[model samples]
Target: MKRDPDFPLVRNLVITLFATNGHLIDMGNRLVRPAGLTTAWWQVMGALGYAPAPLTVAQIARNMGLTRQGVQRVVDLLAARGYVALEPNPHHQRARLVALTAHGRAALEAAEGAAAAVDQRIIERIGTERLATALAVLGEMRDLILEELAQSATPSNDPTLSIENEE
Candidate 1:
């Protein structure tokens, strides 16, 4: 909490005030745009790509900290655009399942490769040690923030913002 010993209470408050979403939105946009996806679509693709089994919109929302309605919107868009296909949920007859299409899987694979390339380039430029250190710090900070948010009993904060936590 003591970011700087010399800085006083108001300075700490200023830092805490900056613990919001604007910079993250900008970062996510920059990271996803080169792969020809928005933050939302990329997140949906990633969720489907990585899940052990097909997920319902509600299930995806639970995992991704999204609202059911919000995830349903993404599912609808993905399905309409042929990025995901719906099947009957095995766990619930009344519920539907969402999974990636062949095209969607291909797109996600390519996007992941592109993202890796950019990550490597940044690491190379920054030097691996510095990059690793930064990653460690960011990962820890993200976990701490998410844990704090969840402790407040608001686990589902945003849909488009599901990150891996660098674990």
Candidate 2:
């Protein structure tokens, strides 16, 4: 079978993206550790901090591009640590809204402060123009992938694109 000419390039891009994500997470964990928070904890708290109001676990998961169960675990841990509070959701009875408490906000702020310094170092090393270009490329890639996902049908709808066949 003739391979699609772009397959190799796309595969390389995906491999690089995955590796980059792992590296970023490791760096994020280190940066947030001083605030007694892991990357996952900081991410959830940051989402809450930036939001106009409280959000449900599902909402947070969707926004973060994570699984609901994974986000739920993080929310539970945050609540147990007094970093967040779960309140009654007027919009949904079962799905309570999660909000950052004062403690959570402080921790998130500390994490951001730490990250700001690292961000500056990165900018110094990579330069603003190069970083901006990289950001634009990544944003475009993400948008295109999201569009493809939205339009995708089930595997049964396209056997040629099935997991087994793709592999």
Best by TM-score: 2
TM-score of 1: 0.61
For candidate 1, the per-residue lDDT at 134 reads 64
Worst 10 residues of 2 by lDDT: 158-167
Error of 1 at 52 (Å): 2.0
Quote the lDDT for 63 in model 1: 72
Candidate 1 structure quality by residue, lDDT tens digits, 47-117: 98999888888778867767777878978988888889999876677668898999889878877775787
For model 1, which pairs clash?
none
Model 1, total clashes: 0
RMSD in Å for candidate 1, one decimal?
7.3
